[model samples]
Target: MEQSLYPVEFLHFGIHLKFELTETGIFLKICVVNFSVLGLFFHRPLALNLKAQPGENVTLSCQAPDGVDIEWSRTDLEELQYVFLYRDGHIDSDYQHQSFKNRVELKDKEMKNGNLSVILKNVKEEDSGTYECRFKAAGEGRRKRAFIKTKPISTIQLEVADPDPGELSGCRLNLNSLTGFYFMLEADPEQTLCVD
Candidate 1:
């Protein structure tokens, strides 16, 4: 197998990219990144999938250091829309979104075995959104925890929907309407019938 640079360049939002083409696949390279704005594209989280029906309990799963606190947030909502927050060994509701005030909880209060999953009780359609779980590990020999950086542990795409309501027109669209056919019924005169 051989690989060579494609001789192409891409400069978007101050970040330059060079793509390399190979016999088997294409590889992308990030040449530069802008510091003025948040580099979100370069720091995406690990994605997970979850599905649940409305009115059912949903779990946005994540796991990290056993003792570190975790925060659950939704990206589709406004910035800093903390879906659920746990810090300093307890749940913090100060900045939690109003709608999630009483509907969210930690699956394991102690985060045993590094389980940082959250439980959303009685989920609604509105709950369907992208969720991110982050954790901040404290520095060694530090007696206090600080918000230095919240590294993402996982990103979950939650889908809260009700079962499909069966199609009920009390009649079927035979779909034979487009094509007309002439047929004889009981040896009678030929008649054209198109079922719609």
Candidate 2:
């Protein structure tokens, strides 16, 4: 009598296992595999659109569950660049991009509450781009050398524009009436207001 069982693959908790049965004997193989199946449980990145005037400051907010590792990066660049990184309860600046070196600040104390917002000072036209805020669980096993769980939790699209003389006149204008209006009121009104 001869019988063969087709190879079967099983995946659990980021681990992968394979089993095969042949007439001679049963064979088993186990290997670590990085799979996109892990992404099923993670929340999709939230999209935010923001605008700032040149030389102003802007804050990008990213909300995550407490105790998770957070990483902020600029995704619209030619090369992926880290704007800021927070892991294991502390900020890691070694990987921060040179452009963001002195311009980015994180709300470290609010991290305990699952807030990982960053402030970008002296916003300029060059700062306009897509920014990604990612998060990973803190206790991913150190033994796994190839798997990474970092997933984007937020995506911010920032636009920096030169202040318009008439628009900055402190008049209460309806945003609904103005098509494509993007600036948010979070900076010093005096500095943002344009004097003719």
- Leading candidate by TM-score: 2
* Candidate 2 residue-wise lDDT, 27-141, digit = tens: 8866676643232233445789998878888989887666666678887644434788776667767757788888888865667577889899999999999988876665544
TM-score for each model: 0.56, 0.59
Q: Candidate 1 versus the native: TM-score?
A: 0.56
| Model 1: residues with Cα > 4 Å off, grouped in runs | 1-46, 138-148, 166-196
| Ten contiguous residues minimizing lDDT sum, candidate 1 | 1-10
lDDT, model 2, position 22? 85
lDDT of each: 0.66, 0.67
lDDT of 1: 0.66
Please write out the lDDT profile of model 1 over residues 1-196, one tens digit for every residue: 2221211112225667898998989888557765432222222345788877778888888866555556788887665558987776788787788889999998987788878899999999999888888765422232232321454668889998865544221222343455754332222124233332
